[model samples]
Target: MHLQFITAACLLASASAHSTFQQLWINGVDAGSSCARKPASNSPVTSISSPDLACNAGAAASAGVCQVKPGDDVTVEMHQQPGDRACRNEAIGGNHYGPVLVYMAAVSDAKSAVGSNADWFKVAHMGLVSNNPDYFGSRVLNDNCGHFTFKVPAGLAPGNYLIRAEVIALHVASGSGGAQFYPACFQVNVGGTGTVKPPTVKIPGVYKASDPGILINIYQDLTTYVLPGPTAYGQASPVPATTAWPTTATWNTALQPSTVPTVVPAAGATGIGKA
Candidate 1:
């Protein structure tokens, strides 16, 4: 029948051109059934030793939690396979780019949200947002379309917290295991009194598979780029570095489209995880 609908739309556009990291947001709601994601598709967890790196290891686990204060604005929604959310933007076809991270850990309640021992750090970061030298990494894939906003770092120190968002493709990293990490985790509950602890790295020892930004090579000789961890803690307010670049970004259009739904919070919970 007409080449089977063009072979099922080229296998759903090659599985939305390889995608991962499902959902996580604060100012926009939806914490993916209450953190500990792995809900489905949006793949990529190619053994950084696989504890699902701490969250996905739960693989769809949920006790639900998502609340915020102390400078909210989390947001991080990417998909392209597990029920497809129309994802795909590796700069059009130059393969996936790299750099884009966030981490935090401090849950000893709510059954310890993030498993695998849990002990993450680093707070907010964005490599090549304009680091000159022809800004590599496809400028966050034609200016970040997969959505990844940052915040929640205003001296944070409330209570339950487990936020982790990552995107390190490295375009095959040239070697040493061909870089491709797509982490995801979200379970917040900070109402805030502000103290700011900050300082705790332990995601496979803060990444070190030859750690030169996770083994370089973004197509060819990259001039300069170094954005591994630490030094990205809620700098005042700078969340909008490319709302959703298509023909060159600038499409805010009233924003709010990460498939918003889950805001669950209430099951022996402490409060603030929103309903």
Candidate 2:
């Protein structure tokens, strides 16, 4: 009985391992093709289609095509060469520009998996003035099945710019969410025009009313007062002869006159004199 139980356990473990390995194979096949294979150079340029095989050696896959189970994470990395300059539009007065590339990676299991949906990808060139008549552009699939290249036209103005890649997943199974690659940005430098010097600013030495140094002069001028009358009037009324201003007792007593009467009355009552 114990031997039978052990055999059953081993069988279950083997089944689980087989299931897991199968899922891994699916994910690996999809991502491997997407990253390893390149589209045909002579393939006609067309709008992105469902189950996009443009990058998968012309496979019949459409957009939102997934090989693994539901609910898995997909990773993508897009790259661009610094100076490819292969795409040019001389007829339209546009300058040649380099290509941008994108790649994909995925994680999957028997119950969960993810893959790329290249059909839903789009690119936009930003930082250039809109409404310009001269702009050349074209799209090319990169060597990797997961990446695509966008070329800029010739005669583009020299400036900083970003090439944004927009991707959307369409056929995610229930309970599984789709992933989108972040927009890619690239800096572009156009031919240089003649160098021009920047203008210099010069401030005169004139004293400004708002200057802090002028405040001191204004305060001193306000504190200096000139009397309109003679010295007697110019001086304040001797501080009102107040004892509060005098610290010495003698000075305080001298400021006040003697309070005693100058004359003495008769000792006894008299008609003309009073006691």
Q: Per model, how many backbone clashes are there? A: 3, 15
lDDT of 1: 0.58
Best by TM-score: 1
Q: Alpha carbon lDDT of residue 113, candidate 1?
A: 55
Candidate 2 lDDT tens digits, 133-230: 21111112111212232223223323322222322211110112211111221111223332322121111111122323211211111212211111
Per-model TM-score versus the true fold? 0.29, 0.19
User: Top model by lDDT, which number?
Assistant: 1
Model 2 superposed RMSD (Cα): 46.8
> Please, what is the whole-model Cα lDDT of each candidate in the order they appear?
0.58, 0.20
